[model samples]
Target: MLPLLLLLPLLWGGSLQEYPGYKLQIPELVTVQEGLCVIVFCEFFYPWHVSFTTDQLCIYWYWTGDNTYSNRLVATNCQNLVVKTETQGRFHLLGDPKTNNCSLSIRDARKSDTGIYEFRVWGQYVQYSYRTQLNLQVTDLTEKADIHILEPLQSGSPTNLTCSLPGSCDGGRPLTFSWMGDALNMLDPSTLQSSVLTLTPRPQDHGTYLTCQVKRRWPQVTTERTIRLNVSYPPQMLGSSCSWEAEGVHCSCFAQAWPAPFLHWWIGDRLVEGNSSDASFSVTSSSIGPWTKSSLSLSMELTSVLRLCCEAWNDHGNQSVTVLLLPGKSASRAEVALGALGGAGTMALLSLCLCLTFFFIVKARRKQAAERPGGMDDEDPVMGTVTWSCRQKPWPESTPAQQSHSGDTPPSREEQDVHYASLSFHGMKPQKSKDEEATSTTEYTEIKTSK
Candidate 1:
């Protein structure tokens, strides 16, 4: 009866003190990704006892359903106790129970480690367990590594890039880091396995993928981050070529740069804009990726001299090149030598036709004047003139005295009035015209008339 009375008070006081000051301050749930880490902050309180000392406090974290001594323990501050083989180094008791701190730190968490956990405190003449439990949920690792660039990537300049995984701590399974990308192909092979990379960017590296991969050896977990590089660079002229197409010169110029450089066609100091057309020149431009191509087609006269230039520029810098649009006329060239030649030939042919027309007109007028009446003055002269009279008024019978002397009979008065006259005509051949033949003639005539 005496031993029964002594145990009753102890049992009654334990039950009454359980809910008053004994409590655990900790989150009810904790979530962590596999192969990552987490920290569970905790603090505990209990009724003070005269025989208990802070130095003798021992904290135990149990993984099994029951807190019995036979169950496996994940973490404990007592040096003589043993921890589970699976969580030997992974689970840590970071806080000292002497300060009422019962914090737990987990590293390289595994999926099998998900379960309810309880905190127990033991000391001389006192032993207690918090009814509040911590539930851990470890799911698939869906997080990726982070890549940080120190500054904007510029061509020909060295830059640093850092890679790190989120929720990773100093004391955990060592992670292996590696870099993968087209831009890293030219670098030393040994440098690709480091967490930090030194990169010298170029114009060709723009828009190329750069990947940072992180791997955990213990759990064989992998995570990666990919980013496209943006490298700023000056414009670089690739090449320029020209060909005669139909009636104009088709010229193409190529340039490459970051930020898609603006292309322009220059004739001396004039700026040729997009799809511009005039009497002598036309231009068109387009871009794809980092390359820009500009085309110029122009028809100019043969006598004209033109100098064609292709210029490209961006925020970084500028580039330019002079293009030859013709073969032999490279000294002072036009867009199309063939077009210019064709134009010159047409003008020459028209001039020739006009000259022939004028020549024929002069010859026709001279021929018509020669056929008219007074056009012969330079080729023919006038001949002698002859005069003749048909009427004879009594030649006076050869003068009446002459008739008497010649023993001519002078008839009566009427016969003497009717005198006879003789006239003679001599014809000389006149100058023949172009189409006629010359002739000669002579004739004599006798007439008698009464006055």
Candidate 2:
């Protein structure tokens, strides 16, 4: 009995009421896609071996904005609440008493199910409540699928395509349908229906892939389907076929398939990736019945000789054709001749400019020489000589012969005088006493002459 007493406290510690009641927890705030399930956790403070049941617990779900419960009640403890028509077969309530967990599973979820959910727990001696909100997001599978083009139809004919759900449609508002591609929403479908997109046969409409998508507005459901178009038409090359005028070495492949076909370019056995210099494609479809054609163009940076391969493909298969860009004998010879002519013409133009520049430079030098003083000799007929006199020194004594020509040719005389004066001015002076008597006699003679 004393041992039992000692163990009493231990037993009580291990018992269910050791702590407060069970607390529910839910970490997930949102879920996506229809028929997806969500779990709400219920944890107890004390570890207890309790029987799991939802008999006394009530769970209710409502959208965030509405005061009343959402149209759909996924699960309830009483099983009396009416299940929403959309969620009828999609939801379940699971409970684990030992773990105190009450979780809800929603099958084929819808956008309408997105909202907050409330849970209420009521027992004989304990009444506890907790709430966890679920943000349900539903996405349509159609939105994720790929759209492609199919080929092999007559050129210049109409083509038709069907876009349907790729997989099973889990019961919900069937996804709404829409189509887009080169036509840019040519077929505007307001509701969810199998859409048939049609285009006329034209070379430009050849390789485009039209896409069809299915989407639901509420509980966002989506699905997708795609079909390639094959509008058979004889291949027509865009731009020019002549090799000399070819803009680039690469070209685009196109076919008018009922659905748009895949376009590709090939050189011999190698595939060509189209770029600015290569051929590319754009597609458009006619509004009338099943005829579509695609235009294929090849471009190259004017090569002398080349061979090109063009191919188009779809899910059914692919078709290829080869075109030989052989230069015509005359055309090839003409191109070579023209290339030589162009080079010669360029060289001639450069030579002419150089010659003109040299001529102008010589003319300018001659004109400058003519304009510069004393730059030319007296004998040079191209320029006239100008004489410059030195003002700082006296003129030299000119010889008799030079003096006779001095007045006629002032420059030569001035030069001779400059040399004589430069030499004589250094040491020459007047004679003294004998000059005095001579001076007096000369003065008397000058006075008599003045009278």
Candidate 3:
């Protein structure tokens, strides 16, 4: 029972002892931008009976190991440290001892104000003490903000953007900058004095804007400069040599210009429209210069003959050139040459066909005549032999009446009857006897004598 009594007293004594002294809490480091405000807070604890009195409270603020009066009197209860004559208008000491709240405020800060601050507090009786370390980081708001270029104004040209902010600030303060567009951040902190952004100009970059934001130890402040990029190039002239030979209805017009330009074609008094044909254009840039030259070609087919006009225009400006084309003279020459060639070729073909036809017709007629029967006489003996026989009737033996009347005297009826009988026998059949042969010879001889 005695031991229990002793233990209870010991426990009561432990509980009755004063809690630990109030301790000021200070962050290892604090960052603030110029022309801004920051708060440094201090915390502590005290017994309930010890009421906070101005006489009992003595608080002092100073730099580390500061011996000069100028460094020692940042704040003191003996002399009221009013807002006037303070480094910053917002600087002040605020606390509620009942709640153990102690804090400091700084306003309109500057880069030179960056330093470590020490707070010392003393209380009556126990004479409690607390110390806190403060690191003030001073940065420039202007330094924390930046500028960036979004795009370039020329197509196919190299362009650069810049993100720039004021760089004159406390060296200990760090800054970060970035871009807010299609371009990736490629700036190296070591090489960059402040911040910058860049990109190459392209056709896709037109009508786009770029922005820049900067971040530092303080709350981020942004300043943006927008750039509207318009990628433009020279107009392209398309077509072949400007000459009169290329005159006709709906002549082909073409121009190959990038960043497409307005195109038009004209012939004589007519404004030829919708007669443009596909044209090829090319642009080449000098590697060392800012200018690029472009060539364009277009073909226009038209019916009229006059000066051919080609005009190309863009946002930059307009360019046009005219070529005189005498359709009558040029067309006539071309037509004559073509017609002569065609007629010559046709006539040569016709002559050749006619000659061939004539030769074939003559050959065919001769072949048909040769093949016809009874068309040619068979007279030449060298080719084949042919025998022919002729039959003759012997003259009738001289009438016997006539022979008897050879001397001019008249023969009687008996002579006439003998002549008739001989004539009748000859008509029937003549005998091939020696008397007949001799009588035939006598008749032949008498006829020769009569002749």
Q: Pick the candidate with the highest lDDT.
A: 1
TM-score to native of every candidate shown: 0.54, 0.30, 0.28
Could you tell me how far off, in angstroms, the CA of residue 95 lies in candidate 1 after the best superposition?
7.3
Off by more than 4 A, model 1:
1-27, 41-61, 65-89, 93-103, 120-129, 140-147, 207-215, 219-228, 242-250, 272-282, 297-305, 324-451
Clashes of 3: 26
Q: Over the stretch 268-358, how does candidate 1's per-residue lDDT look in tens digits?
A: 4577867688888888889998889998886764232244667777887666655322212222235444545655765465557647855
lDDT of 1: 0.69
lDDT of 3 by residue, 95-165 (tens): 75435556776765666677767655555422433434567787756433445445535554455666654
Measured by TM-score, the strongest candidate is: 1
- Candidate 3 at 359: error in angstroms? 74
Error of 1 at 271 (Å): 3.7
Per-residue error (Å), model 3, residue 388: 99
Summarize candidate 2's per-residue lDDT along 1-451 as a digit string, tens digits. Answer: 6555434434554443332433455654654544333444434322223354334544444344244343345555556668555556666666654345566655555556666655544443334334334444555333354443344444434555555444324543445567766644434444224455555544345465656776655456665655554444332211112122233222222333334444454443455443323243222222123222323344433233334544444443444434444322223446756754765765466557657965886687677767867733232222121221111111245657677876784665445432100000111121111101011100000000000
Q: Which model, 1 or 3, shows the larger lDDT?
A: 1
